[model samples]
Target: MVAQLRIYTINRGMMASWLQLFYEHIRPLHERLGMPVQNAWVNAERTEFIWVRSFNDREEIEAKEAAYFASPERTALGDQPTRHIAKIEVRVMEEVPATAGVS
Candidate 1:
């Protein structure tokens, strides 16, 4: 499986508002699109919001994300969600396949 580690740098003093939007709207929308958020975290300083999403493969990520960004539901959210984001960093990772002789 492939996993994407998403880290968002929330605007200063907007962590609470961003988290509200994420839980109430962003995460729910992703779930409806078959892109479940595996887990999430916030730095102690509250400047960074981190989350992970797993997919069957890289192509699945591309397809689902394309639909996600193009969804009318996402459009309806307008700038409410994005306004709090100051920066975004994404890292794609894949699980190491087991070898036949390896335990």
Candidate 2:
């Protein structure tokens, strides 16, 4: 299994709108496309949105992401958040089973 961590930096004064758009639109689209989100969080100042999604493998992740971004729904609603986002960072990670039970 693998996880994708995405961090989105919102433009000044646009955090609330961006979050709304993400949860109302983007997140559901992703979930329907097979990329189930594990968790979501905001930074202390609320300027950044961070989320994690799990996949069976890297290929699954790539395929789901490709389909999601290329879909008609995405084409229509995808840009809604772009204007509000200053930057985005994505990281693919593998869990360390050895530490699974360790706090």
Candidate 3:
């Protein structure tokens, strides 16, 4: 299995509003992505927020993410905040030991 992490450094001024909008609109798509979300984070000083997106395998992650991103609904949600996202990063890692609980 492969585990992925998505870190989003968001603009401080818009955190609360963006978080609410994200939960309201993006949460469902993230869930429907059929991927595990390890957790979402907010910095101690409320400077940035990080989101962890986990996947079971590379094939599943690569194949599914495009469709998720291509959807019209997803596009709209992504367009919500223009200046909110300061920086976005993704990390993909293969587990040292295999865990095949993917169904």
Candidate 4:
């Protein structure tokens, strides 16, 4: 199992719209693609949106991402966020079993 930490930087004054689009559109699409969101948060400044999602393997991740980006639904809605998103960072992480129980 693996987790991906995604951080999205929203354009000035666009955080609310961006988050609405993410929750209403993107999150459901991801769930349909088999990547379940584990958690999500907003930074104190509110311009950054951070979320963690789990995947079974690298191959699944790649395939699902490709499918998502290629789908017509995504193609239609993807550009809607261009005006709101400034930057995006994604990190693939693996949990350390030894520290799994630590808070």
Candidate 5:
């Protein structure tokens, strides 16, 4: 599976609206898409929202996400104020092995 990190940078006073979109659109969409969302966070500074979602493969991930976001519902939501999102960063992360084995 591949993981995606989406960082949304909000406009100066758009936190409330952005969060509304998160609940009204994003979270529901994730559930509908059957994508496993590992975590969701709102920055302490309150200017960003971060989400970690995983998909079985890269191609499926891209296609599904593209279609989802391209839909009219999302397009209208995207029109809301945001600093254009900091960036949508995706990566393949590896878990570090633990050294403590035997008790």
Candidate 6:
């Protein structure tokens, strides 16, 4: 499985607004598109939002993400959510298999 990690730097004082939009709108769209978010977190200072998603393969990732961005639902939301983001960092990661007897 391939994992995608996204870290978004929220604009100052916009954490609540961003989270509301994400949980209420963006996340639902992701789920409907078969790209449910696995987990999410916020930095202590609330300046950053971190989330992860898993896909069966790189092609699925690319296709689903493209569809998501191009979706009519996402288009309607427009910049309402993104305007609160100051910066973003995205990483595609893989899990390392556990080694036997290696705690």
Best by TM-score: 1
Candidate 2 lDDT at 12 equals 78
lDDT string for model 6 (66-90, tens) is 9999999999998887799999999
* Two-way TM-score contest, 3 vs 5, winner: 3
Q: Per-residue lDDT of 1-103 in model 1, one digit per residue for the tens? A: 8999999999999999999999999999999999989999998485999999888899899899999999998999999888999899999999887885697
lDDT of 5 by residue, 1-101 (tens): 66778776666567777778777787777777767678888884967778888777767777887877777766777654334454445555433346646
At residue 91, give the lDDT of candidate 2.
96
**Regarding TM-score, does 1 or 2 come out ahead?**
1
Clashing pairs in 5: none
Better model by TM-score, 4 or 6? Answer: 6
lDDT, candidate 6, at 40? 99
Per-model CA lDDT versus the true structure = 0.92, 0.87, 0.75, 0.86, 0.69, 0.91
Question: Which prediction has more favorable TM-score, 1 or 5?
Answer: 1
Q: How close is candidate 6 to the true structure, as a TM-score?
A: 0.90
TM-score per prediction, in order, is 0.90, 0.87, 0.77, 0.87, 0.68, 0.90
Candidate with the greatest lDDT versus the true structure: 1
lDDT of 3 by residue, 1-103 (tens): 6777666778768889878977776767778878666678888484677777767778898777887788788787666755678787788888774556755
Model 4 residue 95 distance off true place after TM-score fit, in angstroms:
2.4
Indicate the residue-level lDDT of 44 in model 4.
44
lDDT of 2 by residue, 28-85 (tens): 9888888898999989485888999999988787778789889998999847868988
Error of 6 at 22 (Å): 0.3
Q: Residue 53 lDDT in model 6?
A: 89
Runs with alpha carbons beyond 4 Å of true place in candidate 2: 44-46, 98-103
